[model samples]
Target: MSERVIGGHVAGLITVGAADALWAGLTVGSAVPSASAVFTGSPTLARGGYVLLGRRVVAAVKASGGAWSVPEMEVRRAAAELGAVGMDCRDLVRIGPFGSAPAPHPVHDEGTLLRWRERIARELQKPGGPERAPRDGGHRLSHLAGVDWRQILVERPRMGMAGSWWLPRTVVRLLDTAEHTETQWLHTARTRRIDNAVIEPPPHDGQAQAADAWRTTSQNLPTAPLRPYSGELQGLVYSVVSRKPGISRKVARWACAVCGTAPAAVLDHCHEHGYVRAPVCQSCNTQERPDHLYSNDIRVAGHYTRLFDTDAAVWLRHWHRCPGCRARATLPLPHLAAWTAHVACRTQRPTHREARSSRGRKPCGALRVSWTGGHHAPHTCVLTVVVDFCPSGEHRVLAHVPYREAAEQFRTWLAETVPAVAAVAGPDRIDDLPTHFRPVIADTSSEGQALF
Candidate 1:
């Protein structure tokens, strides 16, 4: 039979067993079978027979034969035993898997089985069935301190058969118990702080000095003091130090100059000059790495070193001009600042006076409130810098250095610093350049101003 048919047949048999037990209790003056007893006694072999009986019944059923069939005599004996306990077994014997008949009887029969089903249902509705007692909170604490295999098996029965199915019962039991010992060790290890603790090894004759130096370093570099760097970042620094020449791993563990908080994991250097740059954290290094012009590129590096004295002209000369368009691109600092302020204002509401003025009387004598609460214009004008190199005819922005002071700083870098550097180092030292110079200016005109 198909699994579905078999499952249905098994379900019918359980109902029969329950009904039989109820009948027996009423007729034989015997104690009524508990729900657990009914569930355990039901001969529906496919549905967790091993789980209900624990170990003994599982062994007996397995030893009898394959899961597909059980000994005919064993089935009859089990029926008789259940019958002796006052459970009606006639229906089970007539229509179950152990029954001699080939075909199953109609389940809707108006007879003893039907009455038994009703009686069992009514009995189940009444309270006072078997229940597991509340577990002591202290036992849980004790279990964590040390594992008890017996208690674990009783509480979590699936562990008993979780290993190899063909293995002997004793071996499976042993494996299940041993598995928790490893888990207990892992739990203990997680709770302990042992990463900073050093286990000293016995020193040999010649290595005494090296051992003393190692101990000194270890004593000085306590984990509590190194909270600035994440464990992963520290590991990365150690890896970089081992690979890179001249850079000490110990020094790299210190706080980064650029970020002041994170560890200096990467060795920053000028690609053009082949000179070592100051140590910086990974995040700052990543951000600045993309803008490096050459190995010995001192102009760009100098701008970083002297942040206040930075000139945009010096850095703009390093930018690549598009060969297709022959246009040099420069980012407008003032327009970008206006756009940033516009965006910031878009998130807030306007003053009460502005709100009332903007919402003047409509033609229908009704006031039309500003959709943005008079804080922002209905349409936003985006300010962008157009670079000559855009092959797709799209505007390319360099940086959003808005505000007058910041804009002046960027303009000075482009106009003064770049030319000054070129004057000393020779213009040919700079990368690709247009035949003519383009003046970088801040758009301060009313039309170019950002609309709020």
Candidate 2:
């Protein structure tokens, strides 16, 4: 009852009988048994009635507890052979490749074959069972292909035509033949490259003028001299052009001012010392504050630009501060535009380092704190500028400063100081602060400056 493989010994008799019957059908010349006997492979023969004859074989397998995993199409075909008139019922039978030999030993009588036929019919009526279907057009070549041979035998078991038929030397010959066919197929595909079929070429563009220019140059150029020249010409210029500069202007300028960024209308000086700042694109400036606290590098500023583009920034205004830092982040056009233009105009000269003229160098001025405060952790103020007494000593704070200690503090002050300049402004507006201002050092406001 359980769908497990019973021992060969347990189902050995049933396995053998099904196989023998299937073989008899394939080997036309072999002296075959009655149809019921062919299907059930009952050794004992009986006359009189079909019922009594077929019952013995069924009782043998059922008593042995052999099970069938496959359906009953071939078994029914065997049944149909027995059901036909006379015993010349070979027309009702189909032949397939049973491995090797024909049925071994004594054939069953007519009556047993008839009864086995009726029992196989009864087995076919079961619902939700492996329903048999015609395979490979019911041709003799089907068995040579070994198509569904296991299903015909072990799966149905009643067919008695499984292993014994296919394992034959003759069937092995057929298998070798099939393998040869497959080899030929693979060889054709590899040698011929049939998969890569030729395709038509695309149409050429009429507006392509480069070819005409090349033709004209070929006509104008003199032919190679008759003799080879040994002398070299002086001042020969070899040219190479690149749309993308080898070194990014922003990176060059920021790292060392000698290698400057692109040019722009207005320049953002290092307000603390009035050092001429590197040209930064308007795009870089608008996305970030001059603070340099959250993100200082131009590359980082570019990344934020992509993260909050014009439309995205307009949408981002609904959520003012960065959820991560809670700083007063805004997207203004004037700063962005100025930064874009600045980077575009500036260019770095590789030889500018060698051609230095230190004519009008000025002394480093007194410390001047320019910017301070806005949600900077551990300490407040988004940015601050101080002057150092020694080149590397702890810097002294400057007098006037703009500080933003918190989100509310910065936004409130920005409304008054910078106002909302523009959603998108031009190159001139990067460091263009409002006219009205005060020095934090001069005023004794609410709380004294937070200096460490």
Candidate 3:
């Protein structure tokens, strides 16, 4: 093997085996070869060397059956490799497929698909590349490089910028600098620091500069005017402030500005004006949200859904809880108050619905919970309970549990409250009842076809 260089006097790229040998030698009281001498004999720190090194390291770590953290010397060596690698390797991801989609290669196991792809995509598709994506309150995750970087960050520098940040610095720095200056390229790349080159990577949706994110560009930024920013956390303040616009995560962490509770759980903003008002807790978030105003208006509903985009598991705060029946509701988005009224309506005993039986006296309560869904999907069954003679008149969904057991519990609760609703008796009643309660589903042959 001979010396290799990428214009820098230092050699680039190192094998995981070499790294292991170096670390093992350092741990014990043995002497290893010079770092430059070792790396120079290996492959050039171009795209091939970079990719192979990462793959070998990940494989070696996996083979060792320990955690995915590379050693300190290895991390430092990797940084030196990035510094020495030529700027021409533009498509290492294209070559390595490190962050490719739809079941492609995985570098960190967890981050390769979504997190790495997102960060790498953010870098690759900047000014000279494709259009930048609009931010939807998603913050940039720092130190997404290796393991959970936060877990072992203390030993980082005797090491390097944890291999997570240092290694990807290859992608972030090398890829962009091929087209731009080293300093200019560092402006927006995802890594927090590269050797002495420290920078603040802005949140995905933030307009703040990478150099100084908290320093507002204009005298009059569209920042929330309610309060000033304050926090012990340094790097994330820009993002937290951007999400709520008015307050930092620290302010939101301990007190709801509206109610002044112990702490706030939600980042609340105004839908109409698009101004971030304050951070609020669950109860306050529900009370302040004018969901009723959005119930009927299609435009407003669309805006609200887009703005909030509540995941079903997050349990969007709602004001529809009952006393004895416990009308706690959890539903997916497209959440109109009218659509979710059944969550509240299901708790109250529905007025006895007149019915006709095959033989004699009619059984009451026409199984008011109407739904059409997959054969065995527990949560897929969106139950809409239409209570009889209830003043609301319109139908609404009370709740849809992710687990069958939860749905069954809900049905049991309904059964204990309104016996006739759960036990279908009349022939006409069978059509409107949920599949779990109905004696027979008219169509059971189809696997996924809707059974209404």
Q: Give the CA lDDT, 0 to 100, for residue 205 in model 3.
A: 35
Q: Give per-residue CA lDDT, model 2, range 201-285, as digits (tens).
A: 1233321222232222222222221121111111111111112354222222221111122221122222221222332222222
Which scores better on TM-score, 1 or 3? 3
Highest TM-score scorer: 3
C-alpha root-mean-square deviation, each candidate? 30.8, 37.9, 22.1
Question: Residues 1-452, candidate 3, lDDT per residue (tens digit)?
Answer: 21222121112223444544443333232111112212212222211111122111211111122211122333444344433443222211111111222233334311222223344334333453222322322333322222122221111121222111122223432222221221121222223334334332234331112113222111112212123323222212222355555453344334444345224444453221122344444334433333221122111222233223332112222111111011222112223222333343435433433345445533123223344342234466454433332343534333443334344444454455444433431222223222342121222121111111
- Give the residue spans of candidate 3 off by over 4 A: 1-14, 17-70, 73-268, 277-339, 348-452
lDDT of 3 at 278: 44
Sort the predicted structures by lDDT, highest score first. Answer: 3, 1, 2
What lDDT score belongs to each candidate, Candidate 1 first? 0.26, 0.25, 0.29
TM-score, cand. 3: 0.21
Worst 10 residues of 2 by lDDT: 443-452
For each candidate in turn, the TM-score is: 0.20, 0.17, 0.21
Residue 438 lDDT in candidate 2? 19
Local accuracy of candidate 1 as per-residue lDDT tens digits, 1-452: 11121221231122323332432333232221212222223322223211111111110112112222122222233334423433221111100011121222233111111112122223222353112211332211111111111221211112233211021222222222222222222233233325534322224332333334234322232222222432332212222344666454443445554455544544543222222334544334333322111111111211132222332332232221212111212222222232222222223212232334766532111111111111112033222221222333443333322233333343444445455433333222324432233222222222111100
